[model samples]
Target: MKSYRIIKSPTEGFYKEKGSKFLGFAYHVNSLEDVKNKIELLKKEYYDARHHCYAHLINDGNQKLIRANDDGEPNHSAGDPILGQIRSFDLTNTLVVVVRYFGGTKLGVSGLIHAYKTAAEDALSKAEIEVIQIKQSFVVEYGYEKTNDVLRIINDFGVEINNQEFLAACTLFGRIEPEKYEALKDKLNLVHVKVSKT
Candidate 1:
């Protein structure tokens, strides 16, 4: 995907039904490490919780990795509904975890699903959602004579230049959206400039 929505920061909300309480957390995550770290932190924070159901969507350049765990709840009752909320928002690179306090009442499967769904929805509703473009990094090398052409390409493609050098041969380090990276790489190749992924 060229772009996707994600929460701007960590957020949380709560729901209660039949004396059972669900505490939902939403966090912006970009890697498996982030997912693991957040889960670990929550587990320590809610050590007495009966369950810690969670769902995560991580986009790593070429593909999306998803994880949903019921954490002892009935199959598809907790995790799946939380994941459904993420999907309903068309979001990626996010994680939602629901920590349950038994409250001495066992919610049936349907009730559990509704509680988890509402908890996730409430957390997301409090989040600041923003659309972000997928980016790719590249290093471009060209002769000094082609400086203007290289600058033109950067300007035209909206490439973000991170570093550059001016010498007999010039080097530019930059990043751009994937689509623009492909098109700019092709055009730069025609000018005898070298472009490689970073």
Candidate 2:
């Protein structure tokens, strides 16, 4: 299994050019909803800012989802530059937003790009990078008679149990590398454990 890098926590960065101020925020996001919520909060906090541009990259199954928004800035000026910083850092499941407070100055396209890029770069540079394995979650259910056998198979296959119930019918919520899932499923099926990906 391959590992990917992401920020451990949210971070902020700043840049000022030609009297205009740029505030940057970087976050480790899990889904599209997370990105939208963060942007909404920032918009409310920086209500008077002239623009709120953003970019995000998400790992969804075998595909990488990416989006960038200029928020009325000249096309490709703000958003793409911010996304470029994300790409340079080789990070996934991350979102970067840059808010601009225009200070009666019109930063030409080049200037805007530099400002956004620098702000995003600063934010990412301040983040604590973390590496994580790609994992898939699954649920396993089995009768009490096969509880030990099912649990042993999961344990031997390196599945991390996140939750469990020890009732008459056993249930376990676990996560493991996707590559090992098929093998694990086969082993569990032998003992009549019902397994399904979550």
Candidate 3:
């Protein structure tokens, strides 16, 4: 199964309202509670906006669920379109909130749909998306002289150095791809480094 990553935070905005044209941002979120919390915060941030709508998808390995709300717009115009965007992107464990400041003009159902979709696409364009994976942590110990070489090897293996302790001997606490455990162990063997699974 595929895993997903959430956007870090603070990347959100709205477009100018053109005769009630849709303007909003889509955000990636980690949990259902986080989604609700973000919506509440945005509500306070845009307190005067006419509507604040949202949608979210949460997926675990075997089961998936979705939730959405129109916030004040017509029953299906705002929220459904935003949810559709989530589905279209094949995203999970994410949330998107669209805040609208009415422009003294009304956009019909179709117009509302287009606006929401465009808003989501615009936000997604500016987002940096990544694939999430399960990883394992390890501790690597080697001679001080091999520090640079060990770093190079770790980078080549697509692992991350979580922490480093510098003593007479350099010790690295790191994380590596779970699936590449054997390969990483073999590579460390060539450098005479000791790797302990954490």
Measured by TM-score, the strongest candidate is 1
Model 1: what TM-score?
A: 0.91
- Whole-model Cα lDDT of every candidate shown, in order: 0.93, 0.94, 0.77
All candidates' TM-scores? 0.91, 0.81, 0.63
C-alpha positional error of residue 138 in candidate 1 after TM-score superposition, expressed in Å: 2.4
Candidate 1 lDDT by residue in tens digits, 34-148 = 9999999999999999999999998877788998999999999999999999999888999999999998878899999999999999999999999987689999999999999
Which is the better candidate, 1 or 2, if ranked by TM-score?
1
Candidate 3 collision pairs: none
Error of 1 at 122 (Å): 0.4
Candidate 3: stretches off by over 4 Å: 8-10, 60-62, 134-198
lDDT of 2 by residue, 1-198 (tens): 378999999999999998899999999998999999999999999999999999999996668889999999999999999999998999999999999999898999999999999999999999999999878899998888888798779879988899999889888999999889999999888887899999
Q: Which regions of candidate 2 deviate over 4 angstroms?
A: 1-3, 59-65
Q: How many steric overlaps does candidate 1 have?
A: 0
Q: At residue 178, what lDDT does model 3 achieve?
A: 77
Report the Cα lDDT for candidate 3.
0.77
> Against the correct fold, how does model 2 do in TM-score?
0.81
